[model samples]
Target: MKFKSAFYLLFFFSAFLSFDGVAQNKHTFEIKQGNFLYDGKAIQIHSGEMHYSRIPHQYWRHRMQMLKAMGLNSVATYVFWNHHEILPEQWDFEGDKNLAEYIKIAGEEGLLVVLRPGPYACAEWEFGGYPWWLQNISGMELRRDNPEFLKRTEIYINRLFKEIGHLQITNGGPVIMVQVENEFGSYVSQRKDIPLNEHRSYNAKIKDQLVRAGFNVPLFTSDGTWLFEGGAIDGVLPTANGEGNILNLKKAVDQYHGNKGPYMVAEFYPGWLAHWAEPHPAIDASNIARQTEEYLKNDISFNLYMAHGGTNWGFTSGANYDKKHDIQPDLTSYDYDAPISEAGWATPKFDSLRAVIKKYAQYDIPDIPAPFSTIEIPSIKLTRVGDVLSILEKQKSVQSTTPLTFEQLNQGYGYVLYSRKFNQPISGTLDVSGLRDYAVVYINGEKVGELNRYYNNYTMEIDVPFNSTLEILVENMGRINYGPEIVNNKKGIISPVKINNIEIEGNWEMYTLPMQEAPDLDNIKKNDVFNVPAKTKQLQGKPIIYEGVFDLSEVGDTFLDMENWGKGIVFINGINIGRYWHVGPQQTLFIPGVWLNKGSNKIVIFEQINSELKSEVKTVKTPVLNKLK
Candidate 1:
């Protein structure tokens, strides 16, 4: 019997090579018209973005091992959808807002992933990534096809594709490409010329609802290669993201047909984010390592809009508008002076783009991951105990007496308190016709006034005394970045509140302050109240509190410089580190070392300027104050 059929044909060829090495260790991924095949071959992604709620799940595997030691085989996130459903049906992946363990630790570091999920994703985030409770419903028309914005963008793309569509890459996982709604042709166009075709049938109905909620891969859009030939689709894969070169990426690969297959660049801006007084915006890591060595010497495929610009942390940052109308608002330190530096460290443009991506990477690159861990805390003091109108006049019978307007008190994000009872306290020019950026004017509580939309004159007049009760408060201090007039942003006084011009309305009292529920102050009364003041004495002002204490046994996360303090708000152990303004671009204030508490950690600081010299707690792990330049 021929030696027992050669021992059953060598045991069936050794069990078919051990089941094809367990299907290539199971993290599949295959796609064609833009490459990315994997276990089946054709690869070349190089991705980077980085945003697991802006980095901090214990530094997400030290920022995905410094993006795979810079040769970056893949990693691109966006997820946001209001930082993972902040409420309505509540859902949060995990601490530091874990988006599926930052995509299974970018597949335990081997890499490969590219999600986006949007619901909008303008990247400078907040609102651009939608979800301020979807602007309290009621006729919301964002990114078109408005049926309450497609029923909350199909319930946040079907609960984020049922928690990250089985981790993509064709189900075995590690994604591969998901980006459907991000750059909608950089804000939809093609009207009278007609081809808009309902924005390509709502992005082919979100790619047939992500292949009927399963996402089979091969689907791409990206836009901005001269507006991707009227927002591409015809069998998907258009690509081209921004700041082009190489003959504009070979005319976007001769408009699809020549099949350039995968030449991404989905953002690339090495640095540029600031808005308020506008001046600090630096970018040269040798021109982002000579435009990333001309996109890896033309093998082209990019990402980097933020290789690690972390910390939009709260009120989720976003705003940009330049076609000269100016606008600007993106500085919660998404330090897109990228090449990783919002505290994951590694900069000099991350060693000049990791030596030009390890000289055009063919393979083997991993080494760079060490940095994260800093503690300075020198001299530490920042005291200010009382005022915010004396805690709203001791909670005037539990607040909200009407005047509400940070969108009818659903209160989107921090600071808003209209207040008005002016029996006739006329103070000449006090106009505020839609000042959405910064204002602090009082009368009875007495701080006289101040208004600034970067000095575009929001009308100011002093000395009002008489009937007393004017209080303005208004401090969105962020929003309006690049435009089609951001649907007229509109915050407080978008068209009212005049004094000598007479229209000061009455009985107003709205104080929403969506400080997202933090201020409980344990029934007030805590009196150790330190005081420091007298550096030369200049503490003569409106509602100042400032208090400080620090012994921190050790918890983590730091960044609180707020550039020499001027605008207000900073609280720890009591929480709220949301607002800080020296005006010319936001200046650092993230705190969250899990909200610090290893021992003795109070730190309050209201400071609208009763400036007696305290503000100095330097615990940096990088938020780039450049020592307030």
Candidate 2:
């Protein structure tokens, strides 16, 4: 039978004790007799992985309910480090980054949680959740035994535990398992040129450290099925990550875990990530159903890598490189076509997966929630605020002998402009040796050819005029969060702003444009901040902050249609919704109703390209997510 009274008593008691003394709370989850046991009963985990940083704070439960409706038993999430700690000794867990709130919501909805507190989480995230400032530490080495890295890692882990550690099932919270150093087996060995043997030692060390720090819940490791030797720590549970080939994967797990019971497929690829220029990858619903059935039939457990992939707001989207080390930046809309849509709506894949999972789940699947509707803004005439240069003149600038990284300048996201003047006429090759990601070159306030570090385009031939002003605007499209390259992801022009292999000398002015949201439109023209919308025309090449008003009859979740616009970001009522690119696959940004007012609403657009566009920004129920950049 059902023991509701006993459960409620235990839950309330845990809550009472948890508030007073977190360490006093106690619950148990362990492996016994070849089965995963929770509260003295064996249970199979049908789970999905979603990042709270990707989705908004308000939609956490809506997404959890969506996960439950899809017939998953538990929710898995990656606790991104950079998202929480933007700087040393500082943290932001409020709003969307609130990990504790998300976990409690999952528990309230009758779902369990698996927390992946990655000192490094390569979920297409910038620096793989690593802070950009770590590079400034003289002897800092990440994902290793370096003292500086270890010390900082311990501090972050300790800080995280204080926030959500008490929420673990042991303390009446839903978190059941905590992962150790994500997917380390593949990258660590390759990066250090060491064999898998050393990887085992490193993982064991990391796992031991986590244990010592008091994460008493079951600890596990996740990696590809083929990279078994690389990622598996001898004592921790070994989970495979793949979309196809289940039988061999199980065999590999058995071999690694010493033929242990309770097999796990940690990262099942539901949908693929989209790079700027590549086609969005959509998997067949039939394939998803088949895989779910196969795993259930064999008594195997799995977690879809992205049950609901959300947006990568700001400059947090990452890039991938070839053997040549050219970057392929991922699109901002993570909207991985999972069973749950990015806007938290059900899809055909959800229906198929739900039907198949119903046959095996001991608990009844809940009814699906209706999706939030959309609204239209007939037209929004965005008034031009100013260009990057004009905005720069107002911002605090530092004259440096050399260029500074984003972290060095205490800037987190957005673009950086490095400016210098050449008195004599000089025309040859312009070389920015340490161009971290992408750059736009200009001379004498005129545009020049662009360069992208992702494709190894570093040097360019430019025609410089006499007494020309040289400006190199660098955009950290994203940082490489995976592989050996992730140790230190410092943004912007790292070294000297050079020209033709010679360092440009002079009092160099640096402007940091970590654009989060535009200032109040009425106050914009400290320089030319307040120009009438109807009269402003002819915007220069520099990025302009465009603003206007749109009347709304009612508020709901809507997609900002950008079919004809260039790449930039959108803010509504001073809330940063997300970024939008001319790139196909994600032509619109999701704007939630919670951010809108009843009648008059403000719309701000930071257009990096052409300013001319349709007078009205319309909203549609459908999203265009199949096109490439």
Q: CA lDDT of 168 in candidate 1?
A: 68
Q: Per model, state how many residue pairs clash.
A: 17, 13
Candidate 2, 1-629: lDDT as tens digits = 22222223323332322323233445566766666676665666778988888887888888988987887778999988888887897998999888888887777676778899977889898888888778777788777756798888888888898888778776666788999989987786567666556566667777877787778888888888788777877778888888367678768878988786668889988788877756888899998899888887776778988999988876678877666756667777887888788888898998999998776654557899878777766566664465556666567787887888887887877888888877788878888878987777777555676777766888889877888888887887888877776754788887776667788866788888777655565655555564644434544555667777877778888778887787677788887766676756678777777788888988887766544633446667667887665
lDDT of 1 by residue, 1-629 (tens): 32123222322221222112112345445555555455554445667888888766776888888887776667788777777777576777778776766787776565667887856676767566666656566788566655667777777778777776766655555667887776777566534333477777777776676677777776677767877755676777767776658677666755763555656677777776655456667787887888877776665667877787777755567676564433456666666667777777787788888887666554456678777456656556654344556566445422343444576555666777677765655667877856776677877766676776655567876656667777777777555533345555545556666767866654777654555544544345543232454431333456556666777767777777767667766777775655566763557686757667788888766666443455565656656543333
What candidate 1 gets wrong by more than 4 Å, as runs, is 1-68, 73-184, 190-262, 265-300, 310-317, 320-341, 345-363, 376-379, 383-441, 446-466, 469-473, 487-494, 498-502, 505-558, 561-629
Q: lDDT of all predictions, in order shown? A: 0.64, 0.76
| Off by more than 4 A, model 2 | 1-27, 192-198, 495-498, 521-527, 530-538, 611-616
Model 2 has an lDDT value of 0.76
Deviation in angstroms for 327 in model 1? 14
TM-score of each predicted structure versus truth: 0.36, 0.91
